[model samples]
Target: MANKTYSFYPGCSSQNKASSSNYLVSTNSMCQKLGITLNEVPDWNCCGASIGYGGGGELPRIVLSARNLALSEQHNAGQDMVATCAACWLASREAKERLDHSPQMKADANEALKEAGLEYKGQAQARHMVEVLIEDIGYDALKAGVKKPLQGVKFAGYVGCQTNRPFGIAGESFENPLYLDNLVEAMGGEAVKSYDQKVTCCGGALAFSEPEKSQKQIKDIIESAYDHGADMIVTPCPLCQANVEIYQGEVNKRYGTKFNIPVTYYSQLITVAYGGTAAEAGLNGHVVAPAKLAEIAGK
Candidate 1:
């Protein structure tokens, strides 16, 4: 396969030492195996996430992502802007849509961009990394790159809220997106097709503001995965992975239910399946380590 490249927009969570830094590491390993190059958009800023709307107001929130689009268009012209973080993709895509549809919003955003010595042409298309993996690089090509097939492993594909609702990956059902399931199967792992709560919200920023209510939602997500006999949970969203994996212990303590399921990104799974080591796959960064993947990589 010929090498493919895109302007990468790794959001705040995936930055160095950030909560989802491991996600970025595993993504690099996965792309290397797939022969993809991620040229980061120069001087990219935060996507403002979903929470940005409330705090920063409508225009500021839109401008935040518009700035990123402007930078990507300026630096990596013609390449699509890809983000691993679901929130980043959502926020950026939402900004582009708003600017393109509304002339006033576009004018206002461009005015703000002038302050940064930049302007929004609205040419860059924002996409989640999973879309690039599934759409740009098909499942057949993904399966062909597997050097270590995940034979006995079973994964519960968790799509979460942001990536599923409003504007999801093209050609996928919003309610039950099977792209994650297909990716798991492509990697030689069993996809828990029966696993429900795949589109359940992990409470996003609410997890920090309202722990009690959010933990309950997290409980349901992890519980469903276990009920489906999944060995681990896989997700495309960095927030979902962190919220689901990091909160298991707390959820267990609060609910008096022992839950220790390893939550991972699809990139990490692909990295392991592509013959990358545990470190390369960033498996060691897990709060609940995916011992199965570590064992596979060690072999």
Candidate 2:
């Protein structure tokens, strides 16, 4: 496959040493194997994430996403804007949709961009990295690139909320998106086809403000994975990965249940399958170690 370049938007969560830093590491390894180049949008700011529209209001959120789009248009002209974070991609894509449909919103966002000497012409399309992987690269190519296939590992493809609802990857069912499952199969991993909690909400920012409520949701997600006999839970959303993986201890304490399933990003799985080591795939970053992936990576 020919190499492709994109204007990358590494959101706050994926920054170095941040919650999802491992995601960036694994993504870099996966993209390198796939011959994809990610040119980060210079001077990019937050996309306001999932709650931007509610907390910051419409115009401010739009302006924030527009600034990043403007920067990408100027610095990485003619390239699509790609974000690995589900919230960043959703927020930015929603902003772009709003700006494109509403003239007043576009005018207001462009007006705000003037302060930073950047103007958004809406030239670039915002896309999630998973979309690029499945839609642009194709599953056959991904399967062909696998050097060490995950032959026996069972993965529950968790889709979470943001990436599935409102706007989802084209040609996928929002209720039961199978792209992650398909990607797992492409990497020679066993996808839990009957995994029912794939599109369940991981509580997003609610995981902080309302731990009890959010943990309930997370408990359901993890418990379902265990019920399905999944070796690990894989997702495309950083927030989903963090919430589900990090809060298991708390959930166990609260619910008196043992839950220690490894939650990983789809990229990490692909990276390991592409012959990357445990360190290269960022397996050490997991709070609960993915022994299966580590074992696979070691082979």
Candidate 3:
């Protein structure tokens, strides 16, 4: 099949090494192997994140996301806006939802956009990249692209928030999403069914404000995956990956635990499984390092 291209939103994390830069590298590599092209949104700014919701009024938050949509429509017209970050997907998708459904809200957002010399006609459709992979590309196609299966490496598919809540992607259970699990299995890995924290929050942003409570949440997420015999946890959200992976050592120290499970982006796994090198998948930048799967898949 021919390659499918869409307007891409790599989010703040994926944009730089200061954050989840590996996501950008891995995703780009994986998409190349999968025949999906990502044409990044031009001059994209922040989606305002969760704090944007609390600190500012609705119009500001809406405009923050709407600007991207408007720009995509302006520069990359008719292509669906795809995001790898869950917060980015939620913020953008939520803006589209509010803007599309309520004319007054849409008008108000558009009114704000006029100041930026842009207008949001609500033309762009917001989508999670994983949904595009599952709905548009199909799991069978993903399996076929895997040059190296993960084999017996047990995996915990952590969906976290964003992609599930507000609006689920295509055909996924918000409570217990199987898309990640199916993707893992399709790539020739075992998706541990007993891992119950599949859709729980990873204490995003709160990891800074409330380390104790946040660490507890992260600990459970990691411990559960390990308890279920998972060598690592894979997720689609950049925040989830950052929060879960970055805080592991801290969580382990605070809780007197020795949790060493790695947290990885699904794109990272996809890239390597399809015969891409570790550097290509950005494996070198992982906080916990997916050495378990890396050893199996030969990083």
TM-score of 1: 0.99
Q: For model 2, what is the error of residue 61's alpha carbon versus the real structure, in angstroms, after optimal superposition?
A: 1.0
What is each predicted model's overall lDDT from 0 to 1?
0.93, 0.93, 0.86
- Each model's TM-score, in the order given? 0.99, 0.98, 0.97
Taking every candidate in turn, the Cα RMSD to the unseen true structure, in Å, is: 0.8, 0.8, 1.3
lDDT by residue for model 3 over 1-299, one digit each (tens)?
43998999877877776588988998898888888888999999889887787887788988999999999999999899999888888999989989999999988988888999999998899998898889998998888877888887888999898888868777667788789899898888889988999888888888888889888889888888988888889998888888899887898789889887788888887887888887888888876888866675564
Candidate 2 lDDT by residue in tens digits, 1-299: 53999999989999999999999999998899889999999989998987666789879978899999999999999999999998899889989999999999999888888998999999999999998998899899889988999999999999998888889989998888889999999999999998999999989998998999999999999988989989999999999999999999999999999998899999999999999999989999999999999999998
* For model 3, the run of ten residues with the poorest summed lDDT: 290-299
Model 3 has a clash total of 0
* Candidates, ranked, lDDT: 1, 2, 3
Screening candidate 2 with a backbone cut-off below 3 angstroms (N, C-alpha, C), the clashing residue pairs are none
lDDT of 3 at 42: 93
